[model samples]
Target: MPATTSLQSLHVMVWTALMASLIAVGSFLSIPLGPVPFSMQPLFIMLAGFLLGWPHGMIAVLLFVAAGSIGLPVFAGGKSGLAVLFGPTGGYLIGFVLAAGAIGLLTQARKTARTPSQTPSWALGLLAGLLGLALLYACGLLNLVRVLDIGWNKALTIGFLPFILQDLVKLVMAVATWRIMHGRGLLPR
Candidate 1:
């Protein structure tokens, strides 16, 4: 590979690893609340997508999951191992990859759009973050129903409804952070 290409690859790898670590740290900072704990993971996941773009963001989320599966204390409340993958929150964990991909794609699309003034970047970023949040909740609710043998209503109440407002806040924060980072030219285009 050319030197520039090799250097770019190295840069991507380092960012991916950092994103994975951030996900783990976010999980560690969770507030235990029954089967589903509130964590800062969604914020990092969205940020990963916005800053790293789609492919690298997905890789980072996958790396985070893989580390947790291997018994690393990188999951919510420092829980890990394969058992966590089969637990109630597992679907949401898996959803992180999809969420990141969606957010990254949306943000990338916005970046490539003609007439940038027609649509503010923050609006696109917010939309992407919200979409990602929706996907996460969908996976979480589905898995909650299956894992807990609960009805949809109960799953919604337990997993989705409680976090809506908090997630919206997180979405705003993620968008704001992305805007600042991009504006400062701290993130790769």
Candidate 2:
């Protein structure tokens, strides 16, 4: 390859590494709010999507999952491997990629559609993030239902109800972080 191509490849690799490391570090910063811990993963997930945009953000999240699957201590409590990926929380783990992509696409649209005052309010951004979070839970709850042989209502009650408050906090945190990063010019517009 040409030197320019090599450099571009290096840049891509570096961003990939940064995204994976951020997710892993975010996983460690948790509060153990319930059966599901309150973690900074959502914040980083949104950050990944917004800063890196859809394609790179998705790639980054996928790389993080792959690392965890290969048995790196990239998850909460330093756990990893295929079993953890297949565990109850596994679907949520896998859902992060989609969540990031969705958020990026939606956020980009919101930004393009309105002026600052007309743009989505902070609440709206938080709500959007929550929707992304819900996507993660939807996958998780469905997987739980399938694996645990439970009905949707019961599975949602058991697998999702408890996490609502924590996820709300996460959504708020992610939105706040997005604003902060935008202000600092750390995140792209």
Candidate 3:
């Protein structure tokens, strides 16, 4: 029985590692902007939330960030290190953890709705994803303004405007993917 338990623990660790690697790969596919790059991180973040649920999703994101901080070439533009955490993009990077947790909370809350009919719809899932992204941007923009010594207006112009459309598209795709996969009962939990 002890040997069986040890094997199960190893399996879980392997699963977590695989998910972390997925996030690392997702980070590579990015579109460079002025201060922030539009990246596939959010897609995987939402996927982590949907598939692994609350704590695990957040842990997966944390592991990804930790990997990058420790000199792994896992960030956009092939950047890494503690210095990256102090850079303009740091807040946004940190915010990914919160966003995943928030998304997870929203989904889990919906799961406990008193009536089955009262449960959140696919639209709500999309909203949750968008909200998560917005939280990241909120933190990111604030960091950009302070670190770069720019005013709010300039930050909005340079840091915010460029990514809105691309983010919207991503939000839609994340929503659709969640809806389809969940409806088909194919999502990993």
Question: What is each predicted model's overall lDDT from 0 to 1?
Answer: 0.86, 0.74, 0.77
Clashes of each: 0, 0, 0
Q: What tens-digit string does per-residue lDDT give for candidate 2 at 1-189?
A: 699888877876687679779999988887664335656786777777765666777788888888989989888767789887887677788778888888777777677666654434686577667767878888878777766677889877776777678667767777777776666655433
Clashing pairs in 3: none
What candidate 3 gets wrong by more than 4 Å, as runs, is 1-15, 114-120
Q: Judging by lDDT, tell me the better candidate of 1 and 2.
A: 1
lDDT of 1 by residue, 1-189 (tens): 699898888888999999999999999888988899999998899889988887888889999999999999999999999888888999998789899999988887767664533433776888888888888888888888999999999898888877789888888888888777776667753
Q: What local lDDT score does residue 159 receive in model 3, on the 0 to 100 scale?
A: 75
lDDT agreement of model 2 with the native = 0.74
TM-score, candidate 3, is 0.85
Query: lDDT for model 1, on a 0 to 1 scale?
Result: 0.86
In candidate 3, what are the lDDT values of residues 111-178, reduced to their tens digit?
A: 66635334347777887887788887888889889899999999888777887787777777766776
Best by TM-score: 1
Candidate 1 regions off by >4 Å? Answer: 114-120
